[model samples]
Target: MNTRILKSCLLGAMLVLGGCASGLTGETYSRDEARAPQTVRMGTVESVRLVQIEGTKTNIGTGAGAVVGGVAGSSIGGGRGSIITGVLGAVAGGMAGAAAEEGITRNQGIEITVREDGGQTRAYVQEVDPNMSFAPGERVRVLTVNGTSRVSK
Candidate 1:
């Protein structure tokens, strides 16, 4: 097959094997954690963006399905049948792959909370607009000169 396809397969395999674990925990934090007081603006998630996302899976299924479909379709007839079979196989394979991937990933909703300069907290039901942005909490960075500040997340 093509070298690109081989590389993609290898890369996908590696990514699939490497699990994702980065997420926030519900554990509460105290003001002492920051050490200093911080002033900032913030927004709350009035609602979660509940998207019925499919999980991610390997592309092997799609490739296999396409190959099988093409072979079966081609075998059914001779010249025209072969072409039709190949096309059908490719489409079927793609759909199968996507579905499989979605099942594996089981992607779900996201609650985006943004903070602004003011203390006023606004709750949005929909996904936050990229331009109309808010900070998650007060931006309290640890610096050699500035030091740390208390910020709520």
Candidate 2:
């Protein structure tokens, strides 16, 4: 492959991998969640802790990376040597791509420990929303739908 074509392929793969990330913030909802009924409970935040939200794992990232790597590696030598390097590149690229996808999509989150009005204590974890901030003793609402829960002011 030409150098220009190789660069373009790599760039396209990166874009595809980046686009696979989805929002996990309290204010963000999946299409299935829209207009759905949710159980709402009133609570007071007892504590707030910072946390890390792991990224998604999908075949798209690994496959894209492998293709890019295989092409790059195949360009390294002639004939049989190219084949060997291509295979090795695909394996290494797959692993690297998975890690890159995770790192790229990883998010900062919060663990909110709340005391419900009904006297039940629970903790909710969600990706941090830039527009929202939680502090100890703040009033909050715990909303749950289809067993997924979120905390909001």
Candidate 3:
């Protein structure tokens, strides 16, 4: 019974840990809203700034790490010492796992400023693409929908 439970827990942890890693890049999309018909605005690229997109922490790392750490720490000693080590190991593992998830999932982004067809200007920040480079004064199409936007040539 104990062995089966341990195996199941480890499997679950591994799956959740996998989710902590980042997915595909290139095109940018909003996480808070669904896709709608985008409104396009013709513009010229005014500026582009390099930036970092922070990763999310959903506790999968902490939970997976605690489970794995406790399992490993259980083999240390016999009584009080074993219990203390297991607890400490679990706590340390959780923190390390969370950091690992953050490091893995963090993204590189760019903040692009555009001068629209009219006198108005707007700025958008999105994930950077190696294939897409926006030069100052270059023409672009600003597509926006549901409070999210992207700039493309």
Candidate with top TM-score is: 2
TM-score of each: 0.33, 0.94, 0.78
lDDT tens digits by residue: candidate 2, 1-153: 457766987898889977887888888889899899999999999999999998878887788778778777788888899999989988888777778778888899999999999999999899999899999999999999888999988
Q: Which stretches of candidate 1 lie over 4 Å from their true place?
A: 1-65, 71-83, 112-117, 120-153
Over all chains combined, what TM-score does candidate 1 have? 0.33
Give candidate 1's whole-model lDDT.
Answer: 0.43
Model 2: which residue pairs collide?
none
For candidate 2, the 10 contiguous residues with the lowest summed lDDT are: 1-10
Candidate 2 lands at a TM-score of: 0.94
Q: Which residue runs of candidate 3 sit more than 4 Å off their true CA positions?
A: 1-35
Write the residue-wise lDDT of candidate 3 on 65-153 in tens digits: 78767766665787998898789878877887687667667889888899999878988877788988898989999877786677878
Q: Put down candidate 1 lDDT per residue, 32-114, tens digits, no spaces.
A: 53454443433343323434434445665565545545544555566887788768866875666556545655544334433
User: Global lDDT of each model?
Assistant: 0.43, 0.87, 0.76
The lowest-lDDT stretch of 10 consecutive residues in candidate 3 is 21-30
